[model samples]
Target: MSAPGGNWGFRTGVNDFWGEDHGRKTIGKTILVTGGTGFIGGAALRALADSEPGTNIRVLSRQPLPESLRTGEVLHVHGDLTDPSSLRGVCEGVSTVLHLASHVGRDPELCDVVNRHGTTALLADARRHGVSRVAYMSTTAVYGHGVHRGLTETGVNPLPVSPASRSRLFAEQAVRGFGGIVLRPHLVYGVGDVWFIPTLLRLLNRVPSWIQDGAARVSVVCVDMLGEVLSGLTRIPWRGGETYHVSHPRSTSFRSIVRTVCSTLRLDLPSRSLPVAEHREISRGMMPELTDHQHELLASDHWYDSSRIWRKVRQCPGPGFSSRFARAADWYRDLLPIG
Candidate 1:
């Protein structure tokens, strides 16, 4: 969300995806969205199109978009974050920058280059172009994995573990230093998500079990709704550089997610259960990809206080995981059908 003077037109829909627009401060404003080809980015593209009519949208990408991803009236500009020179002109005429582009990989250098240095370069370009506001999509993983519950945005220190999270922590600082807003979502799941669910299935594929019933409470949000939120943030009259936890207030348990996945996707996973010690040993021996940090994420609580953001938009949290996940079930079914 933008700072106090920027009036963001936002309200929750009573019977729709995300409607009830009170006032759209972004009308006729050219909004630039980066990483518009990735999982959550895809959803944001559509959501922005639906939510804010008459707003000029510029999607920055290194490669041309495929035919299927082409949204109406979205001007695709050829740009790469890694190449700082390429970003020189992308921010021209861009009133607001929704910075969702990030690097998520094991390569520390790539992460730093894209997430930290790239963001700094982007912010510099935006400043030169007189871009008024910027919003960043950071991850709660910056706090690392532990039993975090009901944590506020300003209360905790970020002890990042992975190269990705560490780099993003620095990215957040750059965004904050520029008087921009930051949103930290724990687990985002829904259509086009090739990471969260598939990763879980990978762990289960190697060892079909849970660590002590897998009751780790995690905050989850559907991509569709998240897209809508990001669009609003571009125009919302928010507190400057104020961080918010963007998630449903209700925490969904890991065991419940597994059960839902099995039932919805008809997967015969979790056929057996294991204790924490055995699970770690087997994962270490067979599936080394399942790092200890990943295991800790699945075996503990990570929920944040997201009421502030919901209130900012004058909306209540949408449906819980069961109902919300059902909205995108068909897409997932087609993508990961395994009856």
Candidate 2:
């Protein structure tokens, strides 16, 4: 049973968790954040620190703490998810847990070991330590191979096409069994991102041919926004099986997004066209990292309905599509490293 206002207790369907005061009520709570050094995890750390200054934050990292994280009252713990013994004392006295670490490589075997088995280990340890609430970060790619318009949470059982997604789904099953909240978000982009924007920038220079004429409508969310929603989730109480989709209400078409980003970067858009099979062949030769499933993601219309999460947080609407892309273009070209 879900308690009301306890460590894991949160009111359902209430958007006032973080009011005009910016979630000041969240102060003084202890939260252990895994993957705190990664792109989305780092954003969540900053958002939590900024919103609830008094909140005690613990970050789990396998490597030494980065210089930037050492400035504040953040506690950095050295550990690896694959090594359960390394996780000692990390969950002690923590009221909440955010599991964001995952193996994002192309190997299905490794993906299961890290994403599935690793999560299983962490959840077991957290439960043992009396952690009240846990939030698992998931991907929209879980719903694989579908032309979705406004897919709702629990809308479709994930038909994961890739090993990464399959493993994530497996992890989701574990989280659900453990009574933790699951957040499934689509392509997240922001300042620290090295893949999404940089890859697109590189693609603009080569590959004369494109897929589906770049007309797929894709759903994407800003990293900071996703962080805020996640922060809110930690405080709000919910039933053990609650799941939510995270994304902006508006959907941006692939063609328009690419054209706008290219224009901002002062790069030329791919004007040439090719059949789907031929386009896949060229991408495979050039960008071997993109798997067959990824190619389909680029070519198909995939988006989600995020009204369930949106109603729970009072966030200022972001800028328009063109302006958002323009800002990201500048950041990708200058601030973010591309190679």
Candidate 3:
């Protein structure tokens, strides 16, 4: 399925979709959400708005926000991460800041500029404006490739394979000193997700092979659930530089995920197998649009241990592994053009 425009509000009635109230506790502070227009940040903002009606939110975005999300409590500010001067008043009166904007590209220099230097500039502004707390949405890709089982927060982060991941690691280093929590979520998917699942579906349309026949075990999280985790963070007693891995404790096989996706979409799975090198070369020739890093992700495992964060959030896995994705499958499918 192709990615749709960013219009994911409560229209789909998935706000309380997980069968939980999602914590009605109020933060009562003005919060600034960078990348609020994106998937994770947008979901987190909606969850926060539902849970805390009185709380005010400031959004920094380069695009026009959907009319459905621009309520009185939600304020929009124009800014770009590449332009530090444009971020002049974004942190004014904001007690908490959620750093969600980062470059997800192939260029090393641009990635560092936006992900590393951009974060550095934002945190500096937050500190200067007396922002009390901050939260960073880092990725599990920082841990690198291979069969990672039950990986911890302080677990050795191997050299990143993608330029985006490497830049995020540098950003995490800057955020470590910013006096708040860092959440590293793996394979976050749901409505409005343009990365994890949608990208795979698009690639699978062209490539007809899987690495190791897609038997690798991996960890994943629902975007709404990740948003819930972000919303609940303000209420928790977290120390500065404390990092947490975010995902279900259980891991699902990569083959099962692909099968479920195909079944849900009424599409057929690839019937042939090829060596990793041949498949990579063929896929690159077939779809020159996708980055090499994105292609590598489908072949690796990124399972992590989320027991500690799960206990603190006081939330259980919403439904069985397959059922959760099945429930949202239609939403993703709708984003694709009907063939």
Candidate 4:
């Protein structure tokens, strides 16, 4: 997870994050950023701004942006995704669009309204405005839960079960139909995370046990790298809609995830390891948010081969999870405040 001020490796300029030079393609361009104040959006917004200091940026949000994002360089556009009328002229004079806003909850109608219908309206507006390029943020959960290991972008068929995932899949389909790019990242963690870290902490707080000691290996990315990857996408010469899995080259064991979280927050580790069957019997329905399928997913392999994104952005995935986790210990401790 990447906090706003964490080390995102943008010292020299935005081009430095990409490692190689592409004439700084984003320079002086009019780019619009949706969901610019959310967790991932905030990180990506910061990186995009730092990449090209003088570029014109339009941030769309239903609520007011934080003081941190209120720099004079950015043009805040007040709009709501749920209301298509508000997005009528939002994309005008914009060269690039970064779609990051979505409804992530159990409400199916809300998800359909915000994630699916909202995106369709935005894309329609983008096409009418003659926007040059568009990029969308998606999740690997669109593939559903399984023993997925080292799967390519198109290796597995998308079988989303959750309301949020299903609506996002529809949004992805709309983006591809408009010939825009889609980026999927699995288990993104760092400073601004409110899902992965908080949910895991809740699970551990109630029950300090895992099925088979969390041996399942999963692919993950830090928020800083993820933001840079999203900002770096505008520079790629992509056409006709392409999907890429965005994560580190390496994978981490679930055991290591629990170990690191516990160590970082000074929490107790699982004292007993139970078989999957027994664990299900005891853990099921304990948390209304987590289901039996999610429990199984937590214990299975979810490694996705994301080397393509690393190559696309030309940015190093940096060190492994253990090292990266240490760097964000302070942020996690301050947020989670559990032991």
lDDT of 1 by residue, 1-339 (tens): 010011223321211211245344323567778888887777888888888776777777887776866767687777777877777767766667888889988899989889988898889877766664788999999998678988998768999999999999998999998888888988888888877777787777777888788877988888887888887675565556778899888998889888888777777857677888788988897778777888877877888888888877766667888877766677667765321
Poorest 10 consecutive residues of model 1 by lDDT? 1-10
Candidate 1 local Cα displacement, residue 4, angstroms: 29
Which portions of model 4 show Cα errors greater than 4 Å? 1-27, 337-339
Question: Per-residue alpha-carbon lDDT of model 2 for 150-245, expressed as tens digits?
Answer: 888878878987888899999898998898888998877777877666776555545655576887887788888888887776666666767888
Q: What lDDT does candidate 4 reach at residue 32?
A: 79
Candidate 2 regions off by >4 Å? 1-27, 334-339
Whole-model lDDT, model 2: 0.73
Query: What are the RMSDs of all candidates, in order?
Result: 6.5, 6.0, 7.2, 6.1
Off by over 4 Å in 3: 1-27, 274-278, 288-293, 335-339
Candidate 4, residues 68-133, lDDT tens digits: the string is 998877777877888887788777666678888888888999999999988988898888766747
lDDT, candidate 4, residue 176?
A: 92
* Residue pairs in clash, model 3: none
Q: Which candidate is the best by TM-score?
A: 4
List of clashing residue pairs for candidate 1: 8-235, 8-236, 8-237, 9-23
Clashes found in each candidate (C-alpha, N, C closer than 3 A): 4, 3, 0, 5
lDDT winner: 4
